[model samples]
Target: MADQVKLHGNWLSPFSSRVIWALKLKGIPYEYVEENVADKSALLLHYNPVYKKIPVLVHSGKPICESMIILDYIDETWPENPLLPSDPFERATARFWIKFIEDKSPVLWGVFLADGEDDREKARKATLEVLQTLEERAFGDEKFFGGDEINMVDLAYGMLARWMPVIEEVVGVKLLDPDMFPRLHALAENFRQAAVIRDNLPDHDQMVPLFKIRREQLLQIAGK
Candidate 1:
């Protein structure tokens, strides 16, 4: 049996993409069930009763919620092209950076959703500080966070490669400057060129207009 592997996810969510990339990298055969966030499926609700979020992986009637957790499960179950390092310390380091992005990615999103000049500026500064630190610390000299191979860290932080540009367009701000964030720029280019990622990524053209609409809704709610 192939364990009846299936994933519930939304097309635009980077969290969902993380699981997709991890599964694809490991050559896992699975089904992707696209979820409507507005009207979540009963199966998703039952599987993830707490958060009711997507990117839930169901295997052999066992449901695994949360994107990173699903990625870990994928790594353990498949075990061919591993996503985490075998060495304990290296594994911890990869987990560390993944957690870092998971915790700090919100600052960037807050900036994107922010309205009013002062608030947006504050959020922008915070986002810049986080990006600056990541540039120097995580990506300073490594080709990828896992070094030469895309790993959990690279997949976790991949939102910066695609969605940041979408956010930049929606917010009408330039955060990923080639001069200031050269390392990030190069990383984004590399991620875009990756075989699995290149083929599987969502269409930016379709997403841009949708995100533009989302941006306007956020702005209107914020009274901009």
Candidate 2:
């Protein structure tokens, strides 16, 4: 039988887009299963009972969970177009940056979800601190985290390029100011300009309305 590959993901979720970009970059043909995150499907639950999240990569009969983990699995399974670095030290460095962004990502989300102005300001400051670390340490003069071409590190931090804008718009903040984060601003523009990512990105205007609604809903549920 031919190899069977399927991705269970939500269109709006950057985590889902990470796997999608990796698969596309590697030229891996697979079926995409759109997930309803609000009311998750039983299949998604079955595939990932621990996190019960989207962006599950089902290869043949096996299921793989977590966005970054799924990306690694896809990289190893289909090695035609390598995502990580060829050198051992370089690959480890890439992994380290990936983990750093993954850990700090929730801080950005805190700004989006914060109810009051005081809370949002605190979250935003922390977000800037995290971005400063990425700007100073994780990234350099390279066009991409992967150097010239986009790679797994770029995909891991895809939110900085794509979703951060939408989040900023919906939340009413200038999070990635050009003057403040010039390198990241340029990085965001470059990452989005890439053909694969540009074509696959969720519509910005479309996301604004949806995320605005979601932000309100989240606040309401939290009794904010």
Candidate 3:
């Protein structure tokens, strides 16, 4: 029997979107349950007891926590449109980049939550340095990080395509310049335009106000 699939996620969360895109790419039909991060549901807590976070994937009552791990689970279970490359070495490389981004993501978040000029500038510079490293070392000239098609690496970095632009607008700063990071810029554009990714992306206009409020809350908390 095919296992019933359900996804618990927050609409504004890029991490949730990562799992959504993976499921869509692999043609998996799953019911989506939206969660309120401010007041998380009991079911979400039950599914992810450790972190009690959103983006939990439940298949046949078995719960998978964390966005990337959920994607890997989806890929392993379905295995039709493979997210990671089949070659052992290539898959290892993809996993490396995925972990690399996961580790470095906080720098961009720091920029978003920055409350002062000095802090904002510091975060911006750190974010740019991370991007520069990816542009030169990670991506180089590949149309997609997984070569021509979207893969786990591309999905992992999907936040840059949608959320990053919104963040840049909200924060009143630009770190992804085409002139400086041409390859990365092109990758973002291509990633967004891909059929599954394009269809599933959240509306930018809708997200801006929510992000603005969240940014204020974050700053207020930090100030305290």
Please give each candidate's TM-score: 0.95, 0.97, 0.97
RMSD of 1: 1.5
Determine which window of 10 residues in candidate 1 has minimal summed lDDT. Answer: 138-147
As a whole number from 0 to 100, the lDDT of residue 54 in candidate 2 is 90
| Model 1 Cα lDDT, one tens digit per residue, 18-74 | 999998898878888999987999999999999999989999889999999898888
RMSD of each: 1.5, 1.0, 1.2
Where in model 2 is the C-alpha error above 4 Å?
Answer: none
Estimate the lDDT of model 2. Answer: 0.90
Tens-place lDDT digits, model 3, residues 1-224: 25999999999999999999999998888999999999999999989899999999989989999999998898888999899999999899899999999999898687898878998999999999999989888865677877888999999998889999999989999989899899999999999989999899999999898899899998888782
Positional deviation of 166 in candidate 1, in angstroms? 0.3
The stretch of ten residues in a row with the least summed lDDT in candidate 3 is 139-148
Instruction: Count backbone clashes in candidate 1.
Output: 0
Alpha carbon deviation, residue 72, candidate 3 (Å): 1.0
Model 2 weakest lDDT span, ten residues long? 131-140
- lDDT (CA) for every model shown? 0.87, 0.90, 0.90
- Could you tally the backbone clashes for each prediction? 0, 0, 0
